[model samples]
Target: MSMIEVHHLPPGTRAGRARAWEELYATQVERATVTLGESETGPTLSSGTLGPIRLVRIEMDSGLLQRTAEEIGHVAEPAYSFLLQIAGQASFSHYGQDCVLGPGDMSLCNNAVPYSYTAHGPVELLLIRAGIGTIREHLPSPEQFCGRHLRAAEGLAEHAVGLSQSVFFQLAADLPEAVHNRVARNLLDALATAFAIGFDDLISSSAVLTGRHARVRLFIEENLRNPDLSPGFIATRLKVSSRYLRMIFAAGNETASAYVLRRRLEECARQMADPACAHLTITDIAFGWGFNSAPHFARSFRERFGEAPRVYRREKLAALATGGGALSAGATESV
Candidate 1:
């Protein structure tokens, strides 16, 4: 099953609702100052994790939210948030740009910097937060696009918004982990495409490189179970020189070997924490995810997860049994 969380202020006094709004933003979204504009009704929030991505659905009355530079220091992991306005009207200010969004409008915001959002009235929003590294390869300079509202009724942007909304609504706590991860990846890809529509010339100029990079990533994902996966092997399979392959990955602030190792370790960790894999031995799980040596896998797993694989799996399973759901046993290290 996947992990999901729901929070609500209920029908309460204005003060109580304001308190709930503050807590919800601090914990679920990011550190921010939330002011209730109406102060008549409370807010409701439902959020869940889909692999590396986080989806949040918020329904609230008029409010003004601000995340100052001082608050950004409190964020341990920086991410990019894509918001789809489901109803009402709102304006966002970030990256020296201020834009108003109506229903069916989408906008991107970076959590690393200060931002402000003001809702004109009651609003409903569906937001997707993804690791910066996950989308950086596609949109090299996301700041330029941040705060620029895109009409969801036009072109690829519309399809992308629809895809994200459908996935968010259909996600369930009991869905297969693989399905959840795949859907997350798909949504990211769709968003990348949607964001690129605003910069057609830029995308056209880099189409070849972007296409190749995507192909390489797809190849790596498809063959993660191959113990012999390496930069040389991957380069050979893609018919590219090893040096060129390294250059491509380097441009994205990653090395081919490091990328392969990270993916393998991530796969092993996912399987280790999966409930269905409880019957498998730790060593078996490691090898199944392409690790050739148990000792090496254990060492790498500990380095990545801050604990041994066995310990992580046990703790995560225990947490699940107690209904204390977590996306991972430990916070994921930056890519």
Candidate 2:
């Protein structure tokens, strides 16, 4: 709960405007900077270490920009970390996996894994330096925080962005040491907790009983991908009652069975629409989509989509390829 904010002065004293960067005191300054013609110049070598986290936020100038980014790969390979590009883009190599990150884009990886990257566009890096060693010393496994990249979801970008600014504001602006340290600790904890909740929310949002029922839904969807997936199994896995799972889904215009069936149908439609899947029999398609029985699949498909699975796929694909007829009928028809 401590907060800090800093905006540096623009070096634009040309028109005789006041100096943009003002020393607030011994350890704080605020300014706004706007770069003109880029012959490339800046104190890009600057970096700082948070009490338990390595922290830095900087706009790159020519010297750092021109340097081959590959030479700096070692700086990235930590247990839990994310890099956000505010006004430019970067390309990164992580454990032999290459990903290009754009403005407002973020990249995350297990620090224990090998990583390297480069940016081609005007680069601004807003980096988050948090890891298992610093934050997750008590977790079941540090690796749980690693292995996948989490982006600032377009919907959650506003909240996601509050993080970088919070850190930058604190470091570059004034606050008591006691307050600063407390805020820093909270920032790290808040971010890690938010990330953990977000990851859970992500997995659960794809479930039938998502949102208020995130944990429940996550259990259901994760198990859904298994053929043996069922309400009983899902409830047990979630450590919740089957009646509770049923109640959660029932509030969302569905019973658990209906919701599962609908999701399975969507999956089946996707697989069926793939031209590569033509060789598979309808029964095979049904089972693959998680319908344990063919007749039940056919009946459910017809009830849900107003047509048999084969006819629906044929018309949908034809509409997609040739663009007319029953597919048009299906399009405007009721969901």
Candidate 3:
């Protein structure tokens, strides 16, 4: 799983940064904390599995609200920033567009667009970043969503809070898989969903689809050495719904089942090419890739590389014997 980093900054220094934000731009920034356990100690707190996004929490007193607004103006310059002000009151302006927010209100901002915002006193804020590259990957024109405002659904804010609490709680517990799976997937989905909707794209088409592919690719790469690996196992391990997993493959321009087989065949070829493995017979390579039956392995190997595994391995050895190459390939066509 991807890890999250949490940070704890001192109050006064944090307030100063918040005031700088207010003075610099039309927005004030607050001192913040690491929201997730993605990192140990760093500027970015995150989890490994969430991909490109980062989560954070911040707080500022009512006195520093305006003073910190200026700093936000700059923070908004590079990424799509979101703020869920869980408490307090504020009215914001994004190049003259106005939105009033109070406790439980969520706002979305794009740094590339100029905006001004004022909050009432100290409040709890949960913010998330949908990285520059991530937003662009979902849209051809990234600027379209820039410098805009967004309000969170009541349920959404509640859920975001729940996700934040759950991620931290889960990390501390370090519980068994049964306890963590649902919450873990939900946090990813919720955070990703929030960003997807904030950017005004099809939430289902974006985050869920992209995430599924990412999970699948991760599963594939991790099990490259496991000969018994298969699409069925991958889907099961992901806890994916059957129909949904297929759609993910479709979106990724692949057939889940076919891709796994091809990968295994490819891995076998790599092993065959190694001089250190030349002493091993071809059947040794086939079984190592999880092939159970001798004939089935040869037929599949031939189909994958357009030649029997024995022939391919023999050719390499032959070439080596003739001084064409140093180490020849080795494998047996028969078990």
For all the candidates, what are their Cα RMSDs to the real structure? 16.3, 16.2, 21.1
**Tens-place lDDT digits, model 2, residues 1-335:** 32323344345442222222112211221111222223223323223445565555655432112111222343343346555667666666442234666666555544444334444545677656665566564322334333234456644443655776666666655445655456657666555554555567544454444443544443444344467787787777777788778777765567777666776776576556544355566677777656777778888888888888878777656654534433323232211
lDDT digits (tens) for residues 183-256 of candidate 1: 88888888878878755754565666655765576567567668999998999998999988977776568888
lDDT of 3 at 314: 66
- The candidate with the higher TM-score, 1 or 3, is 1
Q: What's the best-to-worst order under TM-score?
A: 1, 2, 3
**lDDT values for all models:** 0.75, 0.51, 0.52
Give the winner by lDDT.
1
lDDT of 2 at 69: 22
lDDT of 3 by residue, 1-335 (tens): 32434443323454454333333223222322111111222121222223354445554443222211234334543665555666777665432235777765556655433344444554555555566666555443333333234455633655765566556545544535454545544654564455555654533467657655654654564564466677677778888777877887786467877776676676566557545477777678767666677788778878878887767776765653535643433333453
- TM-score for each candidate, following the candidate numbering: 0.58, 0.41, 0.37
lDDT of 2 at 288: 63
Query: 333, model 1: CA deviation in Å?
Result: 48
Candidate 3 residue 16 Cα shift, in angstroms, is 59
